[model samples]
Target: MTHGNTSWQEFGQTFVDQSRELNQKVTDEILERTERALVSAKEKIKQTEEVNEILKLRVEKAEQEARDVKALLSRPMREIAEISGDFQKAYEQQQQILANWILSQKAYRETAVQLGIAVGKTAEEVQDLVTQNANAVLENRTEHGNDSNTNPLVKEYASTILAIRKKNGEV
Candidate 1:
């Protein structure tokens, strides 16, 4: 009976030791798996952060491009609006110049028609002189402008007409 009791005690001790080893092995496997899961989760988080940063930069670039496009569209409109006012001013100035030109032409024609029979000039001669003088003024003021090479004959003819008009009190 004493030997049987001793053998049962040894058996019970072996069982407890095996159970403790199994529990420890299970705990170690659980800890290892948990550590692996934690490492994988951390890697996923880092990748997600990298992707998020890239997306943020892309979004910022797209927003800046949109702003630039909007500014480009409005810039032309602003320039056109500014040019429109300039065109209007130029048109008004041109109209005034044309009006002045018409008045001067009318006055010139009236003077030519009324110029002098008492100065020993026939109407035909007076008309020819007026036409030549007009041609000279136009030549000086046209494509070549005032400082260009003027025709000597036309200049002399214009000078003669001016002298005649001044002398006859028809200036």
Candidate 2:
């Protein structure tokens, strides 16, 4: 009876030791898997943060470039506007000059007709004078090519012609 009880005790001890060993192995495997998962999660978070930072820098650079482009465009736009204004002013002045020239020619013709002293000779002389005057004006305009401002005398003549035209309903 004593021998049988001793054998049973030894058998129970071996079984308990085996069970404890198996439990320790399972706990070690779980701990290892949890550690791997934690490492992988940490790496993913790091990559995401790096990508976000890169995107932020790119956006900032783009915004700066947009501002630079806008600044560059503004100068040319303002210059174009100024050039357009100058063109308009030049056109108006040219029109005024044409009107005055026409009026002056009409007045001269009327005066010659009233005097009645050889109209043919007077007309030829007046034509020569007008041609010479036109050439002189062209030469002067070319010489002072940079002058964009209207001449006061020219403006006065233009205004007188405009008034005359208005009175005659010829405008």
Assess every candidate by TM-score.
0.42, 0.39
Write one digit per residue (lDDT tens) for candidate 1, span 70-89. 77556654454455676567
Leading candidate by TM-score: 1
Q: Could you tally the backbone clashes for each prediction? A: 0, 0
Which ten contiguous residues of candidate 2 have the minimum total lDDT?
A: 140-149
Tens digits of per-residue lDDT for model 2, 56-85: 999999999999867755775445445567
| lDDT of residue 1 for candidate 2 | 29
lDDT of each: 0.72, 0.67
Where in model 2 is the C-alpha error above 4 Å? 1-8, 78-171
Question: Model 1 lDDT vs. the true structure?
Answer: 0.72
**Model 1 alpha-carbon drift over 4 Å, by segment:** 1-6, 77-171
Q: For model 2, what is the alpha-carbon lDDT of residue 88?
A: 57
Q: What's model 2's TM-score?
A: 0.39
- Residue 160 alpha-carbon offset, candidate 2, angstroms: 29
